[model samples]
Target: MATTPVTQGSTDRRRFRVTGGRQTSPQQPALSRWELQALLLILALAAVLYAWGIGHAGVHPYYGAVVRSMAANWHAFFFGGLDPSGWITLDKIPGALWPQALSVKLFGPYDWAAALPQALEGILAVWLLHRIVRAWAGPLAGLLAALVLTLTPITVALNRHTIPDTLLVLLLVLAAGSLQKAVGSGKLLPLLACGAWVGLAFQAKMLQAWLVLPVFAAVYQLAAPGSRLDRAWRLLAAGATALLVSCSWLLVVWATPPESRPYIDGTTNNNPFTLAFGYNGLSRFGDDPHALGAVAGTTASRTSGNTGWTMLVNDIVGPQISWLLPLTVLALVLGLLWRAGQPRTDGRRAGFLLWGGWLAVHVVVFSTSNGNHGYYTAVLAPALAALTGGGAALFWAEYRAGGKRRRALPAAIGLTALWAVVIDGPHGRFAPWLLPVVLMLGLCGTAGLWSSGPRTTPRALHSALAAGMASVLLAPAVWAASCLDSRYAGSPMSPLAGPVGPGYREMRHHGTKPRPHALNTPSVRDAALLNYLTAHRSGEKYLLATQAAYGAEPLLRATSQPVLVMGGFTGLTPYPAAHHLNTLVSAHELRYVLLTTRRPSTSAVFWVKQNCTRVPPRAYGRIADGSFTLYDCAPGV
Candidate 1:
């Protein structure tokens, strides 16, 4: 039997003809007028959503400071230093920050410069998704998927900031596309390329990128043209490739001598594996004594709501990424059932399984895991978009065939509308009119589909189908547009979309407050403190010592000078023990210290308060708010 071969040219060239009992490829043809138009429109939409007003989008200062440091010095750049002087490395891997650091170097460390990479990656991700979906299903399906991903509120929000998730999503999408190609062509190269992509994605997100491994192997095993044993061995090869690529940079860091490089933050022994697996990995789910917040005795849950099966549908996350989830689920089930009789290499069924499995694994992991931020849902956008678009195409093809499948489109539309209303909740505070409009469009489409009999024209059917999809998409699009508003632009650390949740409320309130050390400038109070420290400076190696990155970040951002963070990000990680700090002070290598006034101070903080002279608030132009105390460790004092 002649099969359709995946091709880079027009859809016309994808068909193969059997001539003289042999398969022959068709001549390459140009894209149809509609395909070109849709492709351009999708690209345009992505550009606008990700690039418009990106200059003003806020950045994560902690990362921003690190980017600046990396740009200023190659040593810091290689190690992901937290300050220009390379006193300590960032808590997380610096793979995602390399592009931003290079951008800052080229463009002079502007906020937009750091953000440009994410925006470009986001737009590229959109285009890549379109190409992948178009190759598997059709141009229409691919265009729909691209549109859905572009309008995903969380996707839009994260792309506007300098977050790692942007790169992670792009690489994962690349992996999925490569996996599809490997399945279509039955080649080892594309399979290995899939693993390579996942490995690179792992650099952006440590263990989270590995979540799709099972899905990839399962899809390829079921759909790729190979014996089960051969496929299993091929999968092992790919996994090895992934592990090697993931550890490429890690090995470099580990091999560097301790004295030659900055100490790895978030680890007691300065080990990268401990930081990656213990601090960033398993510690996220279970309790850890060393976690900064946990050690500080804070009771806050890291997630937006309580962890459970219903976590995704809760008010906080539902508005961000769950708008079309129900429709996607329905489409997946119906599509799988519709294609049940197809051969094992069936592209449509393979697509449903691949994307559906991606969604399932993430849902399970996030539902049960702790320390999950809502924006972490950004990774799910591509899978959801692909499934929704592919499902739409599946149902529409069946509907056009004039059979029981005709009910699938109308049912999906109605169910999506109801789900949208539920996600909007009782108040519908963010966009009250959206739910009603969705219902109205859904009703119109369902009524038209239900009433149109065999007499219905192709044009009429197309219009009804368009209305049905528009109903399901309306809520997410509007919610995504909310991020365009300055009030809803999101915070640097935690990006959220829509105005319906506690996270949004908190972010909105905090988004407007000025950072003490924004960009290269410091606030007036901090400027005064910096002047006092600089004026009283001896030949100390560091300007002063502070509790953690919180105090060090602003000082480093304001001036590219070295500021010692006694502890790491949370002031709980054991770095620079009390004795070491005392030695520094006694040796006059550090003359001043700034400790938080919060109770239960770390041993280092307690030591500073006991051994160093308490600088008068008036001396540093501070009002003694009891929040922070500046200590002077002058040698003769």
Candidate 2:
């Protein structure tokens, strides 16, 4: 998405600047030497932050196993099917997995390869966001926004995983930048292109991608040069194009005979359309009474008392993303006020509306929805960074303009900084030097903004701005650093938002652990199970069966042998009913079953206990944590 910020792009040719009404360049030049150097420096920093010691970042094993399976066959790859044998498709569309599958396939399906693509994609998002902001505001704002996004804890955590959210965000940013070009230049093509990018994002993540549609329509209607009627028609055309692009994959997957492909994993009826509309769609906004868990396998029932306006303060979201919440709010307010004096059709106002709409929509939807996860806050990171970064820079410029507005800008920043420090302050386990550095910057920036001195020393202003940036940047930077240093990894990535200390608590709700349970791998127990399964197999369709993918994942990745996950992801879904499992056993299609002591369904545990011979712990080497029991489906004839 952030394809080299070169000069002469369609979006850059516009006359109006996002920071103000400055006009000079006919075609925006490439990043100057300082700009390029600065950009690379931050990108390097981001790379280190995102990928350093990344192999240890315990990515979800279920997803990792699916990618491994996907690498074995293209049909499984295309369908996001859970297994290579094409037994069940993953809950969501397969678009997001394509890149991960390729990476795993090419790199031998290791943890590093599974996560590297998403990390790189997240880095691209940083650059793309910088370019987009730079095109609207200026280089300074762009750099600031980029840095803020880079340090976002949730951003780091999610990017370090194999989840599709990072890629989905990159596609959205690309779509938004294109839409801005369409509005600025009155070009139909850019609008179509924007639709295409967003459509692809929809393929990556279904209903959530459409959140920005209203903003896109409004920006074109308000700012594009064409007549209102003309713009409306063009908008409709773009919408149709988006629909076509979004549905392209869905149609193909749906058109394929159900019997020929795997049953869509998350749906009751084995249909992609039903999965999209049911489990992964509206069910995300509200829990499905009949369903056992969220599509993301997160529980929405834990509120931490976060509802209504208190949503911002909730233990779930506050630490990960709300550090700059106040600043973004101020940005929306000030950005709007700054533009109110200009033409009603001013593009700056449209930019605010676009980011503001995005901020508001996600906040409200996540705030109100019971099905929200703490990691869902990753969606909020970009909008907050764009507004706060670009908005803060805009205020600094206004203050340099030397008026009452200038004085107000300092007070505004000071208050916002105060809010951020208060919200995230308790979470920082900083060295003694850290607080002083943050305070000094806050004071210097506050003084510079507060000063009514003559316009003689710009260095003072620069110092103040740096201080402000430092103050805003400090806590999240520290916390994100802690996230890397801690043993923390895996899904529900946002809850571990604070530093690795007291305030950094996980959300224990809806029958799930508050944090990722440490997975034991490469252990003697696992090796023993693998050895037993490998030795006993004789033309069986599956070498093993487990209550959930979690137990079988180590073996799945260790060998090419197929494993039947009796219950899907959560181990609660009623699958391969007792009789059906017996049928498979009778046919010698499955032999070994591993019953994890963790949340297996009652019926499933009962079936395994009554029907199979329980292998003694000593017979299979050391079983750590007393968490799993290996059973022989039928040891010998």
Candidate 3:
């Protein structure tokens, strides 16, 4: 038959023509013109939310101080020391602090300079989630998943700060994406890269990176085009690769001489091994299930009843996150129900399994840990978003095929919509009018889905789907918007997001407020103490000795001078023994010893109290806690 030629890139046009042949319809592009515009809009929104008012002095002055110190010298930067003195290391890994250090080094040390890298990393995370979900589920799922991630308030709050969790989350997302790419290509190199990504994530947050390895390995083994034994071998090699990457810095720290390197701060012994495997790792889960301050958020006064599973429900996570949490759980259930007993090599099933594994592992681990923070739960946001997008897309595609599943789609849509609003709506802080509008639109969307017949057009179907998703998203979107302006100075641990009125002010680092121990900036009282130390320095390395890092932080930040903290975060851990303190004083490395009232008992404190003279209160300005004693630790005083 004589036929008309088809246009290039048009498969359907080639298949059918009006030359004694039938015609074919045009198929849509992977990302349609409007969808592409929508994607850009979503990314723009994320950028504004993450970057807005990000320049305030950081929430955790401790890490900000570390970043400033790391930017000053090579030793402090490499070892992640608590200050420029390089006398002691910070209580965490070096890698997590590196990006912020670099940011400060390049842009000059400011809170915004330290936080800029994390904000950028957060933006990239949104884009990466979209790319990964789109690969497994399709473009619509990818776009929807990205939208969900950007709207998560906890994600926005944590990302806007200088916390290392932002980097950890980004690296883990990269690892997830790498494995998805490997499954698609059936390539060994991409699989290898996935392990490397996980290893890098470990550098960001030690043991937390390995949580997803089981899911990645299982997916790769089943989906990769290779023999089972060979795949297992490769997986082991990948694990080895991850181990090596994570342990490289540890090896360097271990290899260094004790005298030349800063002492590891967190552990009982000043060593990297104990710091990694003990303090920051196993000790996080208290053996005694009900240890005090074991689980975070609940121990705080406002979150009084937030314990166990409810930790992620109301006070801690419910209002901050959990807007789409019920739907995420529903997505997991539906994913399992939809793809029961599929092939081991099923890609969609693998995607669902991966996301489910993330949520399951984190929830169980965090729920059990007394050391868990509300901010720690922020890492779960992307996984929840990915599952929602992929699961919803899978269900929609299946329903469109006119079967038993199709009849249930409308019901699922309606139920999920109602559950999303009802779950956190009452506890949520949103505009008075916003809640009613969300409910009305959600009801209309549910009705549209139920009333939709086979004759319903594609545009109408899409509109209904958009409405349903938006209903799940509205509260979080409002919260995330508020996340942009929230100023949680000193410690930005709160996950509560809301609008900041003119009365809302950033918490400044001054002694006016009842501070833990000297704010980063000096008040009149602190300045008087600083003047005394500066005046009394008799050729000493440390200007003064304090009970913990809290006491020394203000001095170090204000004067760029060396001040020694005997213990670390808790102030109880033994570090410098009496002999070490005597040696420092004898060697003229330390002079004045300032002890906080109700401080942890140490032989060094007793040594200073017995051997040195206490300064009179009249010599220093008015002190908040007069129980804090200043001892003259000068040699032969």
lDDT of 3 by residue, 82-109 (tens): 7777878877787988998888888876
In terms of lDDT, the poorest run of 10 residues in model 3 is: 1-10
| Candidate 2 lDDT tens digits, 175-242 | 98998777666679999999999899998888788888887887677766656788889999999989
Q: Clashing pairs in model 1?
A: none
Assess the local accuracy of residue 504 in candidate 2 as a C-alpha lDDT between 0 and 100: 38
Candidates 1 and 3 compared by TM-score, better number = 1
Residue 588 C-alpha lDDT in model 2: 80
| True-structure RMSD, every candidate | 3.8, 5.2, 7.0
lDDT of 1 by residue, 259-285 (tens): 998888878778877766767776666
Whole-model lDDT per candidate: 0.78, 0.71, 0.70
lDDT for predicted candidate 2 compared with the true structure: 0.71
lDDT of 1: 0.78
- Which runs in model 2 stand beyond 4 Å of their true positions? 1-25, 291-308, 428-436, 487-495, 500-521, 572-574, 577-579, 596-612, 622-631, 634-636
Looking at model 2, the pairs that clash are none
